[model samples]
Each structure stands twice: as C-alpha cells, then as structure tokens.
Target: MKRRPRRSVPATLTAVVLLAACAFVAVAAIQPIVGETPWVSYRSVADALHGARWTDLVPAIAGGVAALLGLVLLLTAILPGKLTVLPLLGELDSGASRRSYRSTLRAAVSTVDGVSAAKVKLKRRKVSVKVTTGRTSTGGLADAVRGALERRLDQIVPAVRPAVKVKVHAVRSAS
Candidate 1:
C-alpha cells in the first residue's frame, strides 16, 4: 500500500481562519440583543458594504482577493499531496521516510575506507553522494563509495531503486 502526504498545515490554517470569522460574526450579531457593545461597529460595516458600488475599486479589489483565496482553498482540498514514504520491495507492505533513506545511504558511503564524511541527496530517480576525504589522491575512491552505496541499496530493497552517483572531495592537509 502506497502512502500519500497530507496538506495539514494549509487545511488547519484555513479552518482556523473560518472558525474565527464565524465566531466574530456570531458575537457581533448577539452583542446588540444582549445590550453590549460589539467588538466591531456592525452598523458602520453594514452601511459601508451597502453603500459601496459593485464597480468601485475597493469592492472590485476585495472581490478579486476573495475569489483568489477561494480558488487556493479549492485547489488545496482537491489536489493530491506528494508521496512522503517510499515503498519497499517484498510481499509485506513497508516503506521508508526520505530522511532515513538518505541517512542510511550516507552511512554506507561513510563506512568506506578513507571517507571522512558523506552527504547523500535522494531525488525521484537519482541518489547523489558527496564524500569528503583527507586523502590527497582520490583515484578509485568514487567507485568504491558508489559500490558501498549500491550494496546498502540492495539490502534495503526499495521498490524504485534510484541510480547512485558519487563525487569525492579531497580535504587539504593542514601542513
């Protein structure tokens, strides 16, 4: 089973804003009945809205903004989010987060001889490994790092194996 991401942040903010607006309207409507001053001057607001012409610049701008906001909310609700988990191979259903996957690959590359540090970047179709080593000559180091990375990938067995590309950076000696 594939796992899909969620638009929680946008949905949450939108819900909060709507709730606040509704609560404000409810309070404003109830204030006069209870003989209390409303937070907003409802009469002025009503007069301004009623008096404004449809073709007025302020009304037109407000209408455009509302339409744009509605469009954004609609699109967010309808669009499918990007996949957060990468599916793994095998009968049992399983997946790994991108962060963990990249770290695992980085660990594999770092374990190779002469590798001081490693950075792994995972993309849809490629895994880029950057290795930093103190060794002056980096001949054949890239290939070794790539091999270790591929070995780790084989062990994990992700459904879609991204191609591994290795780059070795030689750190200069302090002397």
Candidate 2:
C-alpha cells in the first residue's frame, strides 16, 4: 500500500496567503471604478511601477499582512486556553529553587532499600523520579522510591498532592 504524503500549512504562511488573496480579490472587484477614477486613470500601473509609487503601497500591504498574522496567532493562542510562556519563565526564574528541591528529594529517595541513586524532576504539580537500583528486581526499588518521595513531599508541601512517577535504570546485583 502506498502511503499518502502528509500535508501541513504553516500558520504564518496561511495567514499571509489568505490576506493577500482577499486584497487581490478586493482590488479586482473594484478595478472598473478604479480605472474610471481621475487619479487612477492619470496614473497607469506602468507609471506607478516606474515612479516607484508602488513603494507607497508597501506599508499598507505589510500592515495588513501583519494584522492578519497577529489575528491568526492570537486566536490559536487563546483557543487553547493555556499559557505558552509562563512555564518557561518559571524555569528561568526559579532554576535554583527547582534544582534544590530535586536534590533534596533525590537524597531522600536514595535512602530507600535497593536504591543506589535517585534523580528527581519536579514540575508544576508532580514529581518524577528515576531510581538507579542495586537489586536486579526493579519492581520493589521503584515502589520504595515512590513511597519515599511521596512521604517527603507530604511533609514539605502539605497542600499539594504530588503525583509520583518512578523509573528504574541500571539495576545491579546486591552484594
């Protein structure tokens, strides 16, 4: 079976094309009146191009295109009802805070049986942990890591119930 090629239209390009098409249609529809007008009749398209009068239309055309693009982007942004930049801002502003929290959580979870090291990632409402275990069976190590992390979070942030996720990496034989 031949697979169909996926088609994608970039929002910016779509906005520009749509706006330019509308402008062209509008100009075409009014062409007869424009030709009849004294001002337009006096200045032909050749004269406009030669004298660089088309330069004057540049700003208006650019403005219309920008407005259309802005409208498309604004609608796309608002329709989703999610903050696009806030989480990025938080990551930038609170790097140290989050890193410290992660380290502390990692230390606590690493104390659990069979866990050799723990890596913690704390997002807005949840904590994810990757546990390096000293035991071949990762199931018990994952459970222990999750339990420790949840207990630590409950002690620190009582108002928030952090969802714990545990992944095991590099299981070793317990000596």
Per lDDT, the best of the predicted structures is: 1
Tens-digit lDDT track of model 2 for 1-175:
1122222345656778899999875775587676643423434765765766435877679779899978876676555331122222222332124455677788888788777777777665677888776666675667777778878776555233558888888666545
Residue 139's lDDT within candidate 2 is 59
Task: For candidate 2, give the lDDT of residue 119.
Answer: 74
**What are the TM-scores, per candidate, against the unseen true structure?**
0.83, 0.44
- Tens digits of per-residue lDDT for model 1 on 1-175? 4677788888899989999999989999899999998888978998998999988999899999999999998898898765678899999999998888888888888789999998888877799988999998889999999889889999999998899888889998545
- Count of clashes, each model: 0, 0
Task: Determine which window of 10 residues in candidate 1 has minimal summed lDDT.
Answer: 77-86
Single out the weakest 10-residue window by summed lDDT for candidate 2: 82-91
Model 1 root-mean-square deviation: 2.5
What TM-score quantifies how close candidate 2 is to the native fold? Answer: 0.44
